[model samples]
Target: MAEEDAASKRRRLGQEVPSGGGVGEDGGDPDLIGRLPDEVLGSIITLLPTTDGARTQILSRRWRPLWRAAPLNLEADFGSLTLLESERVASQLCKLLSAHEAPVRRFSLKCNGRYGLSQPIAPLLQSHRLQDIQEFELYVRGDLPPSLLSLSPAALRVLHICSRPESPLWTTSTLSFPSLRELTLVDVDVSESALHGVLSRCPVLETLLLDNIRARRVRINSLTLRSVGVSDCGYPWEARLEELMIVDAPLLERLIPRVPSHHLVIRVIHAPRLRTLGYLHDDIPRLQLGTMHFEKMVLVRPSDGMRSVKILGLLSAPNLDFVTGLLKCFPCVEKLHIVSYTQMIFKNDVKCYAPLECLDRHLKKVQIINYEEKRADVNFIKFFVLNARVLESMKFVVCRDKCGAKWIARQHKKLQVNGRASQRAKFDFEADCSRGPSSMVDMKHIHDLAMDPFDRSSCRCHGDALH
Candidate 1:
């Protein structure tokens, strides 16, 4: 009789009862009550959507109360539905949570509705029953009410807050985050003092990312901060931060202890912990350093004229000579890459320091991209080919256009057959350089007086005599 009654309940619940199975064949359906443990059923119900959870009540009498007891997940978008409809959905979600005894683990609310003077957010955040909330993500297209700033910090491990162009909700004294490990502020206009106040308070913060965070001046004094990234922060600001990165910071002037007095200072104060140093700017007058031990470095400038004082920590510089007398700073440099942009001239003055004899010998490889057969460029190349005994290969990347392909091909043939006792120099010319703008030369063709004695191509790299 009991078996027959259980089968009847499975059939009523629209669940299939496996034939020749145990007495509780329909127990696989967690919604079937008395057949499975309540905790197991509650876990299964929590995974269902709010709408689906409500629909499960119609399955059986036991299932009617499970949806209310299960954890709640509320998701609503005002863009698709009317504002009233979205609020109605939120109200139902609140009611469901109010009835539940277990703590809510995750609360995700994304709203695109405009909140004017009439609408309030207290009802959404006043869930005292949600004690186990681990993740809270609030993305509001409109302004956030001041009430949201009072959320319980103990229950939230990760908090992401994004607001549209609206007034801030908290003042510097009122803002507080005690237990946050990671914090991201996006498109939020908060005063510099308020921002620093928040960071100074969050003692355990590991990573802080600021995107489009407009502030007059930002002062960072976090001692435990491991990583910091600031992008598009309008103007000059004093930041005493470690492991720092500044991108598109237009008005940035000074970085703590100004440029060094003498010597190229690249000190890897922490090489094992440092990775990348990327800076892009319109003009950089000087780069002073006490100690910089970064593994990788990248510098992007508007024009080649932007001067850089010294780069001591890295192995390569594309604009080595153009950046003033700083190339000799990296005496320990193992690899060198020189990039020649369009209409950009690479002048080789042997009298300057005999770069071919001095610089190439220490380098393991020399890569010249967009190589043109101008007299100066060729002299620099030949110097590296003959002097760099440790050079394993010299890669001359031809631009996409056929601009310098002919020149590279001719140069490769000449270097290969010359068979001079110099280390058998290898040249590859299967590259194109004409796809871009015309090449720019730095200085006029080297006069006959400037030609080295060993140069067989005369002062003109094109095998033509000097005019």
Candidate 2:
């Protein structure tokens, strides 16, 4: 019964199912999926899990050969494989690859301890057909086969290597990925010289990401690289040896280090067309952006000597002092996005370290996310209401989990009575309401307020847009 239902669902989805297995309401060959072209069938197999992809062969004799022609995307996570199981699985995988007529497009090998370095890994590495692979990932706790690093395909584009915590990644001084575009490394140590050596070889590299990896100095000199992110980097933001330096990358667009202002000391040695940057801390090493004038976002921090940035996003607003100090850093910020969550609220009245010049003059758009009826949240919005003379549109996104529809209505009323500085200013309230806009507010939303008119694209990201 369940089989017939599944066949019907597939038929509705425009997929041909086997007929003799079960008759359709019209009674004929219930067009079998095998009738589809090999390319289309291969695509369908790709969408299934690796196990399910193999299982399709059992559906019928015609389906048996379909899995063999599909591009192989095999991931062997032998972390939990017992010694015997490891040997068996590795043997089977190698045997499967040996007979595979189709190209192996993606392969990932991860081990809990000793599985990656075992003899079985060697056979797979020497398969020679590896030259056809495009995406290769390795996460191992112990030493990797020497052939693995040098075994990458000339056509490989994505390479992610997470090495053991104690040992540095030991690629030969001659090692490089000629066709590599995106590289992600975690918990691997690489000396500055080796790091530069590997990077110099990849001319078309686009994105370089590092997580908890130790490299005293990382110099990106690629012409094609567009985005780079380093999070929870090896050294603390204050370490003398810790420095993130980018030099002569003309197409560099996004340089994002998820580490907080209190955590990174970034120096753009030189990037000509750089677009977005973030997490500029107060304690960063003396930095320079070599006349590459591109609008970038700055995370707010107290007394940061940061300059030449425009946007500011935050998750926590400890006090108005933090806000005041932030405005002082970027005096002419053209755009902003903020949220009214309770953790952002301060316990007492706050003082500004210096006069805030942006909100009084140049500040334009502001978004408040997770807004609630709590007084602390309202006060945060109220601060912007009375100030921000040139403000264009202020958006408040209220969540049902935080407050009910009734409380959100009252909060909007409170803001309108507070009086905004700009005659052209508008406040938009985006919330999940019950009925019509009238169910929330028809006349008020139109004549006075523009409820839920948020154009998300104008912002960098919806939730963590700036932060």
1-467: candidate 1 lDDT, tens digit per residue = 66777778868999766532336544443323445666677778776666776688887677777777777654444445565676676677678777766666566666663644114345767767655676566777666755566675575566666666466534565556667766666567667667768767776665555544555345444444444334442334422122222322222222211111111112222222222122211122223232422222333222222122211111122333542233343443344444454345556543365454225444555445555656656655665554556665565655544425555557755443254224554544434434222121111211111322112233243222111
The runs of at least 3 residues in candidate 1 whose Cα sits more than 4 Å from the true structure, single-residue gaps closed, are 1-76, 79-81, 99-102, 113-120, 233-274, 279-467
lDDT of each: 0.47, 0.62
TM-score of 2: 0.69
User: 1-467, model 2: which lDDT tens digit per residue?
Assistant: 75677677878999766433344335555444545677788888865656778888897776778898887877888778777787788789888888977788888888765554456677777787788888888888876666665685788888888876445565346776889988877667777787788888887888787666666667677778877766544344422235567877777755555433234456676665554444333334343566322122234323443344455544444345555655665576656655333444464342223335787888888766566666666666677776778888787665643444666567757765346777687766665322111111111111111122123433333432210
Q: Global CA lDDT of candidate 1, please? A: 0.47
Q: Score residue 314 of candidate 1 by CA lDDT.
A: 19
